[model samples]
Target: MEADKVKEACAVVAMRCKQDVAQYIYYALRALQHRGQEASGIAVYSGGLKVKKGVGLVSDVMGPEDMDKLSGKVGIGHNYYSIKVSRPENIQPQSLKTGIGDIAIAHNGIIVNSQLIIAQLKKEGKLFLLESEEEAFIMRLTDTIRATDDIAKSIKTVCKELIGSYAFALLVNDRVFAIRDPYGIRPLCLGKLPDGKGFIAASESVALDVLGAEFIRDVMPGEAVEITEDGFKSINIGASINRAHCFFEWVYFARADSVIDGMSVYEARKRIGWRLAKEAPAIADVVMPIPDSGRAHAYGYALGSGIKMNEGLMKNRYIHRTFIMPTQDAREISVREKMNPVRAVVEGKRVVIVDDSIVRGTTMKKIVKMLRDAGATEVHVRIGSPPLISPCYLGIDMTNRDQFIADHRSIDDIRKEIGSDSLAYITIEGLVEALNFEKENLCLGCVTGEYPVNIPGERRRFQQTLEGFT
Candidate 1:
């Protein structure tokens, strides 16, 4: 429940239209600001490709004057969040000039085989300009296939060599290319503008909504799409594998209004709450949410439990996501500054607090104490997702096993630690059922510890060393 519960990966948006699309991409990235806040960039192609990028929020990086400089009809945008220190080179829409053309790419997930690809490229006498794994991997792959005239063939070769999760958008001169990982570990969707003159691809449906585009459908797992003046053409460039869409998208990462892989995130979360109410019913006077992420789940819980939903907490709109803050103390302070209990609603009430998940339990304990200080007689906590017991290797920030409260503690121990009168979590089975998708299609890696992709032993050890757990 701490502010650093789970960090999100990057976001990608690409537009191919008759008119200039730099502004469209700018607005779409703003809609997806929740996905990443560390850095933002955009690449547009008119007569030639132009890109503007910096280390900050979208508004901070791109002012009116900045947007005026990037003029193009086809463009790609990226929003990045790094577990490591953010730097200017790490900022993406990473571009390279090759014999074929200038290539710009924006990526949204981790490439597990990046080291292997980098080494191979090195053996081939190639040099990498960017330090980020995505930039290195993409640039090397582009270099490998620079001789090919067909962009689709180049992308297919790249997809064949890479392993792990990713969804990327590429800008090649006047064309745009989009590809989702074989397992669809990340979300990507295609849409059309109101006049049907342009095509949009983004990390979430909500981005398309902001552009007044009609959602066409999700790009199938392992599929590659190329948008040009001719039309949108797609090919299955990846191997046929079981879909392992990141389940956390519905649980925590996505905007409530977004839909991923045919599942409505808001609807999925509401179902999670509905199922939680049935499975872990807590006796209380009122049902309340933690605000924001907990809102939809709390509404579903209230409906299922036949309890009135009340606004027991008010959030400060000015406060940014605490997880992005620099230090633990800063994040803790953010929690206090972000929300305050409504004494009139919680005073002398047996309140049932519905939340999405509890990671470290640091913020949850503080929240319970805050409610108690404001006169709540009882605080019953219900988490929509099952206990997180393992680290996520596919771009989520929960890579350190020691940071998980559930990793070493029992459910009862967590409840006592958080000072909740009672605590319950939805079962893994219940969560999968609520999603209403094939059970195998969901990656419950954090909950189940069974990763869909094979994690190389060396990489695992390296990650442990980085976390100081070795």
Candidate 2:
């Protein structure tokens, strides 16, 4: 994994000259590296777009020397470890031909009923070299746009046929365009560089921040935005009211500094801890977060619960994120090397470990083991969100259902396996309440299974019942 970029998934793009296109692309990617780390690639559309893509980082896959090699006024880039297609062949910036012209695409999010769409495309006898769910989406959009001549209309029609979440961007015939899914399950923020030479299409605003781009508003749900030499235009195609931003972004994925819907992720998480304290009050002597993202949540939990927040765990900041590790052995080693218990705070006292979520139960088990080894009397585990039983086809790599312990196991069953004295997951209902159900902007697909948008990938894995659990 690349040392500096921590993201495991995402895409970034911008337009114009003055500043080096390839160079700026690299800078944008470094900020978005959190979205994907498996592979990084970039494409530039100067005279006739030149593209470079492979399995590596923005720095590793692209260098200052390489940046000089690519000369394009309009460019789009992606940092991906394709969650839907796992196969390297199935990933992005696909250069395809339509009756209109040649188009290059970069996409974030998933196509829900991909199989159905692919079957239809197959019946039409479209020769597809890349069968990834993403490729199919590009093919569909191109086919529609070619016949319509109106880009927005074509996108609107394509969106109607689409079934899942997505934030799609494309470098089409020297122009760039982006589209957010009807529900906006994934994030797509637009920003302008300090010079106003171009606009950025990014998964998170944090990337925009890094580039000194003014924070442009998030691409609204069901909106299609096009950027050309002339200017930019936005069009809406789907129901605005049903828009559901992925709640997981707040619980775990998003950077703390980002503001979504005008709310800071750190602030939202702190509120989550405060709510958790009220909903599941415990008499623990001290409140300790599991480290990393849980820190802010821990602060809120401590303040709300009136428990003394302690640095019970000593985090070895030098170690990289274990989740980005490609091998199990590497991950295990990273986790152990990165975390250790502070005996001064943990010995002979019951401790509460607040974490984002419990997936396969392996990480939690290992953490519990560490707590016990440190001489803790009892360890209670509290997850900031409910179990993640569904695979996140949109962007996250939580694909394999077999890897999800919550899908097949009960809460009690998971508690026993993790070896925690007690375990409590935040209620889904509580999640809605915390958000004040203020508007129709939150996506609870992972927790509720009722995607505001359709998800065809659900059947690609397991078929378990999590409805009654919440």
For candidate 2, the TM-score is 0.87
Q: Per-residue lDDT tens digits of candidate 2, residues 1-470?
A: 12211133566565554555777778888887767766777788766768787776667787777788787777888887654435666556667665676677777766767888889999999878867666676688788876877777877887778776777777776777777877677788887878656777777888888888888688887788886544458877764454577788877777788776566888888888888888777778788987776887788789889988998877777766346578877866776777778888998888888877777777678888888888888888887887877666566666556667788788899999999988888888776666554434576755655555445433221222323111
Segments of candidate 2 deviating more than 4 angstroms: 1-9, 14-18, 83-86, 97-99, 229-231, 317-334, 408-410, 436-440, 455-470
- Assess the local accuracy of residue 319 in candidate 2 as a C-alpha lDDT between 0 and 100: 60
**lDDT (Cα, tens digit) per residue for candidate 1, span 1-470:** 33646879889998898888888999999999989988999999877778899888999989888778887789999998875534577788888776667788998988887888777777878777764666665675666576676677878877877778989998877778889888799999999988767999999999999999999889988898887664578978764446789989999899999999898999999999999999999889999999887999999899889889998998888866435579877765777798899999999999999999988888899899999999999999999999998888888888877898898788899999999999999999999999998877788888887777768542221121212211
The top-ranked prediction according to TM-score is: 1
How well does candidate 2 match the true structure, expressed as C-alpha RMSD? Answer: 5.2
Q: List the residue pairs that clash in candidate 1.
A: 1-359
lDDT of 1: 0.84
Residue 239 lDDT, candidate 1, scale 0-100: 40
Q: Estimated TM-score per prediction?
A: 0.93, 0.87
Off by over 4 Å in 1: 321-334, 458-470
